[model samples]
Target: MEAVVERFLKYIKCDTKSDEETGVTPSTPGQMEFAKKLAEELKNIGMSNVSLDENGYVMAEVPSNTDKNVPVIGFIAHMDTAPDMSGKNVNPKIVENYDGNDIVLNKDQNIVLKVKDFPEIKECVGKTIITTDGTTLLGADDKAGVAEIITAVDYLIKNPSIEHGTVKIAFTPDEEIGCGADHFDVEKFNADFAYTIDGGSVGELECENFNAAGAVVSIKGRNVHPGSAKDKMINSMLIANEFIFMLPDTETPSHTEGYEGFYHITSLKGDVEETKIHYIIRDFDKQKFEERKYIMSAIVQSLNKKYGEDTVSVEIKDQYYNMKEKIQPVKHIVDTAFRAMEECEVVPKVVPIRGGTDGARLSYMGLPTPNLFTGGYNFHGRYEFIPTFAMEKAVDVILKIIELYTKA
Candidate 1:
C-alpha cells in the first residue's frame, strides 16, 4: 500500500460532499472537518506557514532550499466531492493485477465495470485499480490530486538534497459547486503560477476550458378549474417543453464532444402555475459561448411573445471563462509541465477541457494556472475509478515538475 493510496482511502471516508443550496463557504460541515485533517497532515509533513481559513481553505508552503532564484509555484486541489452522488462510507475495492475483464463492483447489486461500456479501462489491464462498491462515489475526482501533491511534498521534504524553490499548496472547498476560487487569498498564497491537479486520466494537460454560464428559466401560467381549463388555463410545463424543443436537439451534452459546446438542461421543475428550468451553457469559443447565451434569451423572448409578457423570465449568470486568454501570455508554464511529463516517460495528451476546473477561474484571478491530471476516470459518479500505477506516475510527474523548475 503506497502512501498516496493510503491517504486517498483515508480522505474519502470523511464524506466532504458539497451543496450549492447551502449558500455557505464550505456548504457542508464535512468539508471543514476534512480541511482540519488536511491542515494537520500538512503540519505533520513539515510544511511551513500552514493555515486553515474560516472558509475551509488550507494553505501551506515548502520553503525554497537552493540559492538560485526560482519562481514560487502553487499546486491546488478541491476538497469537496460533487453533489451528484453519495460520498459517505465510500467502500473502495482494489483489483490487484487486473486481467482486463469486467469487474464486478457489487455482486448483490449486479453492478459491474464493463470494458465494453468504458474501453479506457482496457488501458489498465495489468495494473492495480481502485473503484467504488457501486453504492457511493469514490472521491478520486480531486482527492487523488490532493494525495499526489502531499506525497510529492513529503518526498521533497525527506530528500533535502533535491533543492527546489518555494512551493505553495492549497485545498479548496466547493469547487464542485463553482465557488472554489471565491475566497482564495491569491496574494497570500503568492505563487507566480499554479497548476490545478484536478483533471481526469493520465497525461492530460489542459490550458483551455469552456466559457461557462448558468441560466434559469422561470415560467408562470394561469390555472383554472378543470371544466374551464380549455383556453382559460395555460400549462407552464408545456411552455417549458416548447422552450426545450427550441434549442437544437443535436447540441447537447450527449450529442456534443471535443471542443463542441452544448446547452445542458440540468433540472426542470414546475406544474401549471409556475415552473423553473435550470440550464448550464458551455462553449470553448468566446463568440460561440455568447451565442449560446443569446440563444437561450432569444427562446425566452420568443416564448414571451406567444405566451404573453412576464410569463417567461430567464436569468443567466456568467460562471467562468476560458483560461486560454490568460494562460497564452505565460505559455512556458504549460511547456514546463509538458516537458516534465515527457521526462517522466508519460505521453503528453494536450486537450481542451470540456468542463471547467478551479484553474479556469484562478487564471483570470492572476494565477495563470493550467490543469494537470490525477489519473482518475469517470469522475463524480459511482463508476469512478483510478489506476494505482497512474497515481504513482502522477506523483512522479509532480516531483518532476518541481525539479524542472529548480533546474531553470
Candidate 2:
C-alpha cells in the first residue's frame, strides 16, 4: 500500500499534461517520459514484453500461471493528465487518519475541501488520504489507475500461488483530447476482454457511456458601416445565438442526468465577419444521438436560408459511440468485474456514464472493455484527492478478478 501511494506521488509530479492543440500523437513530450518510466517499472516487476511504442503507448504481458486455456485479459489506463489545469510541479499532501471534517488544502489561498460541498470526503473517516495544494491538479484521474494495475501485477508476481490467465496491460496517451483510441492497434493488444481502470471513486463499474459526436458551426457574416448597416450587416454572433436558442433549453449537462442526452456548447468565438460555435452532441441512445446532430444541421440550414447560401456551414465529426452496443453481447465481462469487486469487499455500483471513456472506444475496437474505479475524486482540478485505503481495495479488486477467472 505504501508502494502504491509512493508510485502515485512519483507519477503526478512528472507533469504529463496533454495538449489538444499540438496536432501530434501524444500532443505533449512529457507523456513519453511518463510512458518510459512506467515501462521500466513494469519490467522491474517481472512483466514480460514490456515495450513503449513511438505513439507513446506502453504495453506489457503477465504470463498465465495455470494452463487451463483461460481467457486473455487486459487492463488499460492513460499516461497523460488533463490539459484543463496545470500538472506541473504538483506538490501532493498526505493526510493521515482523516477526522471526517473539512480539509484545508491551502491555508494561504483559503482552498478547502469542505464537507458541506462534498459529503463523500467524510466517507473516508479514519483512513489516510492524498490531496494537492490550491495551486495545481493532483493528476489522479488515470495515474491512480496506472498505479493500481501495476501494483496488482507486482503482487501477482510476488505470490505465484495465485493462478491467473494471460494479462495484458497498456498505458495510452491523448485520452483527454478524445484520440486515445485513434491509433490503437487492436490486433497487437491481443486481449479477449479488457477493463479500463479509469472510473471515479470506489465501486464505480461502468459499461455504458454516451454515443458522442462533434458539431462545428461556422458562420460567415458581412460587416458594413453603421450608417448603411440597416440591410447589409449580418452579425454572425446573432446567428450563432439563434442556433443556440433553437436547441432544447433544459437539455444540457447542467440540467440532465441518468440516461439523459445533452447538447453542450464547448466553445463560441466570433466577430462581425466570422463566428465559430463548437458543440458536442451526446446521447446513450444511437437514434437520439443522430437526431441531435441533425437538429444542429437543421438550425444551421434555417439560418442559412434567412441569411444566404454558405452563410452557415457545419462540420459534423463522429468522435466515439456508445460501448453498450459492443459490451451487451459480452455481458459476463461486466459481471466478472462485479463479482470481483464483491470478492474484494467493495460494493459494486453499476452506473451509466454520462460521458465517454477510452474503454468505450476500445470496446468498439474488439477489446470488449468496461470501466473500473480508481478511488480518486475530483480529478483534473486543484481539489483532486484519493483515499489510501481505497487504492489498497482497488489493488485487491484487480487481484481477485484474476483469481476468479483462473479458478473458474
Best by TM-score: 1
Give per-residue lDDT, candidate 1, residue 116. 93
Q: What C-alpha lDDT do the candidate models reach, one value each?
A: 0.94, 0.90
TM-score of 1: 0.99
Candidate 1 per-residue lDDT, tens place, 113-173, comes to: 9999989999998999999999999999889999999999999998899999999999999
- The best candidate in terms of lDDT: 1
Clashing pairs in 2: none
Which pairs clash (backbone N, Cα, C closer than 3 Å) in model 1? Answer: none
Q: Local error of candidate 1 at 228, Å?
A: 2.5
The TM-score obtained by model 2 is 0.95
TM-score of each: 0.99, 0.95
